[model samples]
Target chain A: MIKVENLRKEFPLGRTLQKELATKEKIAVAVDNISFQCQPGRIFSLLGPNGAGKTTTMRMLSTIFKPTSGNIEIAGINAVTNSRDARRKIGFLTGSTGLYARLTPNELIKYFADLYEVSDADFKIRKEKLFDLLDMNDFQNKRIGKLSTGMKQKVSICRTMIHDPEVIVFDEPTSGLDVITAENIISLIRDCKNDGKTVIFSSHIMSEVDLLCDDMAIVHKGKLLYNGTMENFRSNQQESSLTAEFIRIIHESNAATV
Target chain B: MILKIFLKELKDTLRDKRTLIMMVVIPVLVFPIVLNLFVTVSSSFEKDAAMQRVKIGFVGDAQSPVIAGFLEMPAAMGKKDLIPYPNEKALLQDVKNDSLQMGIIVPDNYQEKMDSMEAVTCEVYYDATDLGIKDRAKSYMEYVEKSARDKRYKSMNLDETKFQVILTNYNNTASDKEMIGKLAGGILPYIFIAFGFIGCMYPAIDLFTGEKERGTIETLLTTPVSRLQILIGKMCVVALSGLLAATCALVGLYLSIEVFNLVDNEEILSIVRGILTPSFIIMLFLLLFPLTVFFAGVMIPIAVYAKSFKEAQSIITPLNIVMVLPAMIGLLPGIELNYMTACIPVINVVLATKELIAGTLEPVLLLLSFGIMVTLAMIAVFVSYRHFGKETNIVM
Candidate 1:
């Protein structure tokens, strides 16, 4: 289970020497007063467009960034206070993250497994299962630098799941992948849900959210606009497509700000 | 767990072409080849300078038959080329133009002055900036004086040897081996320190900025490993590579000297052998250990702060000069290891290494120097740890 309450992040801009004493420090609030939860055996999607603070929220969840003022609990461990323990219970992945180019997929996966302190027997079993599921046996021994985009993504997925953490966070994991590869990631998310793991992913693609998320939150301009089950959201749409519903909520938020 | 990170990092380092070239190829091959070329060219130059053909310009006719006979001696044949000038001004012009290695103005009253028992000074001119020409000109002046003295003695029928006060000759009597050791002492310390520091640069950049540039830093940070663990793991590989680089430099220098027979005298060879004993090698390792750590520590924080590999390189490149400059202090003649000098960093290691090699090492100074280096290295590592602990520094 993963829970976040009133998570917020503010980044201060660098000051010029001339204005250092005269002007007050300026800051941009990337995430503000956002709260959500993802239960075990459910897929929760943080839906947002570009610059919508989804990545920042995910970074905080993974303990890579400390929220300015908030509480993050991953699998019953407080993320900020006990980050190492919280990290062991979380597996974070993102499209921009990468594997060592010089290491083969086999070596790369084993490296993470060792970092997570998985036993040899458990690591072997997990490696075999992930390789079979992702159909990565053919190129597991090849260096990652030589692998194509889809193949590298498969290796990344296997690496992310090697330790079988209770909470898995994916931040735009399939943003630039081909349709087939994107479909594979959706299936993997569904598999995680079926295996009773908590899954939180952020994406601008509505179809991905529709296909994978049971509960979803719509975020914009660092604030949560809507939060509920996908079924409730669909029924509340009144025959409108998910995209139209999303546009209406964004327009409403824009009007309120105006 | 740190071992696992080190092993993985080491595997990556071994596979990198740049690391292999910096760590292995250049040190093993480039030094020896360059050393051989330098020795060959220098020795050839020395031989040519020794057998140099000198042009002697004469301003006036020879006064005494004795001086003329001395000038035409068999020893001067083929080696000395004589040119006659109408006056001292013409001879000065030739010497000024460098066409003549030396010029002599035989006084117009040469024979008259001798008959009157008066001292007549003959002017000799040569380009002082040109060592070879100046040396030849001085030798010729000595010959002229000898001939004049002999002529006066022969005229009076006096014993030249009996009238003269004690004659003296001065020359360098040191063996080739001692000279070679002195020369090597001034240079080797700078080379070893530079190589050791350079070895740390690439590995540090690749391990620190590389993770950020490759986007692997994000993944690595998400692991359960502590920041300290990660720091130790990366630094171990960096320090080891630095040690290897320093080793390669010393070994390369040794091999180069041996292969070219550059320091060929047996006495020098014996001194070299004594300097390269098991204890000496152990001392070298001890001195380099903290230095390697210092290099790694200095490199990591700077490299980690950079947003790209190129940026890291630009930031780290100036350090090469910073490191090399202080090490060159060992080359100064009067600098030696002492209590105060041992408190310094690169210079201390340099003076210590030089003294050890020169068989003048003070054990107390060595221990003090080692303590200073280790203390500085610890501070550097501590600073690196503080940098690593910051999420902003690691997450870029």
Candidate 2:
């Protein structure tokens, strides 16, 4: 299970020439007072558009960064205090992120496996299983630079799941993927949910969220506009599609004139 | 676990072509080309200056002994044997004709200075702007002065055998050849260490920051590993890359030194062998160890801070400037590598390597030098960890 309470992140915007010439430092708040939870054996989508606290929230959970004000627990371990243990319990995948261009897919995945200290025999078995399941045979030996986008994403996805963490965070997992590769990834997320794994996904594409998510949250400009079952979130807005609901909430937030 | 990460890093390093060039080939190739060019150009200048053809015709009567002796000097100089002339006007005509560099106008009173024990001036006329010919003329004139001084001393003592004995008895052991060679060797090691540092900088940054820039760091950090393990893993890769790049550069430098046939004249080979010592190599590697770590600590996470490849490029380009200029300071000719310098990181390694290669050092200085470097390396690693351990991890 993963839980984030009242998470807020304020990033200091580099003092512009105008600001520096004046008196005070300037900052832009990226994530603000967002709260959510992922129960065991369920898929949760922290749905948001670009710049919408989705990646930032995932980053906080991954320990790649820390949220400015928040409490987080991954499987009963406080993420702030015991980030390493929390890292062990979570798998993180960024959709647009690339693999090491110089390393072959086999070497790349195995590297993360070693970092996780997975037993050697198990590492080999799971690695072979990923290769076979993902059907990465043709390009497995090739450097990542030479791989097609879908092939690279397949390789990246395999690498993310290598450690078999309890909570898997997929931030924009299908952003640039082709229809086939994207479908494969969606099926993998469903498989994780079927296998009693906790999966948290972030995306703007409402259909993927509609198809795979049991629970979901709509975030706009760092605030949690809505959180509930995907069915409930869509029904509450009386919008047929997730995108329309997202646009409606954004327009409502924009209506609150500063 | 760290070893596995290290091995993976090693594999990654080997696979990158640009990295291979920065870490391997430049050091191996650059020093030799530069040094050999310096040596070739300098030696040629010296030879061309020394061997320039000249003729001197003495304008004096053949009956005069001093004038007859003056006519013999051009032959002794080897480039131009002197030709006797009938009068001063003819000698001047020969000089104007360009048939002679300058006519030696040794007068009848040429030997009178020694007889009276008074200083006599010998005038050499040559074009002021013709530096090479002027240099030769100056050297020949000084030779005449020294011989005159010797002849006066011999005349006062008036014993040929006693004069020879006194000359041999003077207790002096300075050999310009040996001294020059040692100095050359001492300075050469500084060049080698400079290449060592330069050769490693890009590769070290590439090892850490390159990985971060490529987005591999996000994956690495997501692993179920401790921060120490991550640091060790990353550090081992970068440190080893630095050490390896330095080794390639050293080999190239050693080869270049061998090709530098002129350095043999300095008698530095015996001391030059000191670079091969395990302790010297170990100390040098240790000195670089911290810098490599600091670079990785500074660059990798910093690289990750960039939102794009272009941004990372902007961040890295300035470091190259910040790095090479300072190292070239100790690398230039005549700079001394002293004990006090050993406290500075890159500069210290350059200096210590120089002292070791020259074998002109006190062992206490070596120990003290490397001791300071190691302590500092640890501190740098600590600072890196302190920054990496932050909740930001971006050094904000």
Candidate 3:
């Protein structure tokens, strides 16, 4: 399971940023005082519009960015205090994550496996299973730069799942993919949930959240607007559709501030 | 873990055409191409200068003894054709217009000066811009003057040796190796330092800024590795590349001299062969190792701070001049490896290499130079680690 308590991330504003923002503030709060949980065998989605701090929050969870102040627990380890140990238990992937273009899919998989310190026997078994599942055997030996986008995405999936971490974090995993290629990610999320892995993904796509997420949180301007299960969120929605409700919540938050 | 990352980075860097060219191909070819061109051009110039025929114009009676003296001169001085001029003005004009390579105005009654035992001055004119013509004219004048002096001595019944009061002989105590070492030693280190910096530049940018631009750094950071380990691992590859490039340049120099026989001077060839002893190579590498690390250290922070490869390159390219300019100091005359110079970074290496070639380096100064470079390299590495640990610099 992944647990976050009062997580806040602040970035120092440089002179250029201060001028651009027209603010005297020394720091910009990207993720402000947010808290949430992702239980095993469930998909927890963090949903927001663009620039809503979804990526920052996800980065903090994956230990890519250190929080200015807060607590992060990954698989019972204090992620903030022992980030290296916590990282071992976490598998992080993003749509923008780039593979070394000079390397073949097989080489790339082996590299990530070595980084995670997986045993040789376990690596072989996992590689075989993922390759068969993703239909990657045909292109596994080809350079990643030469592979098609769909094939590259499959290699990414194999790389992320090589070490078989307890918690998986996906940040906008389908941001630039076609519908057909995106189905590969959709199926991978379902498989993670079936395998009893704690999964947390951030996206602005309401339909994706509705189809897969068990529990959900809505954040805007770095503030948590809604935190509850999908079932409760649906029952409480006063709008005609989930998209409209998401839009209404953001607009209402802005209106209240004004 | 560091070794694993280093091996991976090495494999990745080897596959990059740009880095490979900078690290190996260019360094290996630079010396041979340059030295061959230099030797060919210089030898051809020498041959052309020897074979050139000069035209001499004179304004004097053809029956004068001076004219006979000129006609009787030996052919070994150089091939020459003499043309008669009516006056000094015409003779000078011919020299100026390139119709004649030189001009001589023998005085009227020139034989009268010889008969009376008085010195007579003859005017000689040639363009200073004509490279070797002035020297050739001086040589011909000296020969003619010696012949006139001999005739006077014989006529007067005086011994030429008794007329000479003193004869002095000059000698040089320094060996050929020492002379070449002092004069040309700066060139070797300058080449090594230049190639070393260039060798480190591309890989430093590619491994750090390229990773960020490609969106791979974020995922790498997510793995179970400390930032320090990653930095050290990549730094090892960068430093190794610099050393490799410098070694390739040395190989190139070896090929030019030994295999290609571009250098034909026996003295210089023997000195070069002596300088390539195994001990000299080990000492050269001893000085270069820390320097390569320092180069890698200074470059990594810039690479980490830059968000793209082009930006890193734009910044580092100018820095190459700043860092390598001091290596040129060794090329200057009268500069030596004193305590102050030994404390300077790139300059110390250059002068130390010079002294090493001359067999005059003191061990204390070598230690001081090496110590200073190591300390600076450590400080630079610490700064790189600090910059790399900063979240704003590492991620875009």
Off by over 4 Å in 3: B56-72, B83-130, B148-157
Q: Is candidate 1 or candidate 3 better by TM-score?
A: 3
Clashes of each: 0, 1, 0
- Best candidate according to TM-score: 3
* Candidate 2 local distance difference test against the native: 0.71
Ranking by lDDT: 3, 1, 2
Off by over 4 Å in 2: A13-27, B30-47, B55-70, B74-76, B81-122, B125-135, B143-182, B253-351, B358-360, B390-396
- How does chain B of model 1 score on TM-score? 0.89
**Per-prediction DockQ, in order?**
0.84, 0.65, 0.82
Which of 1 and 2 is ahead in DockQ? 1
| Per-residue C-alpha lDDT of model 1 across residues A131-244, encoded as one tens digit per residue | 998999999899999999889999889989999999999999888889988888888889999999999999989888887889999999899998889999998884468987
**Reference-based lDDT, residue B180, model 3:** 76
As a TM-score, model 1 comes out at: 0.92
Model 2 residue A226 lDDT? 85
Better of 1 and 2 by TM-score: 1
What is candidate 2's TM-score for chain A?
A: 0.93
lDDT of 3 by residue, B4-107 (tens): 88988998999999999999999999999999999988888778777888899998877665666778799877888888999998888888988899898889
Using DockQ as the measure, what is the rank order of every candidate, best first? 1, 3, 2
> CA lDDT of B163 in candidate 3?
74
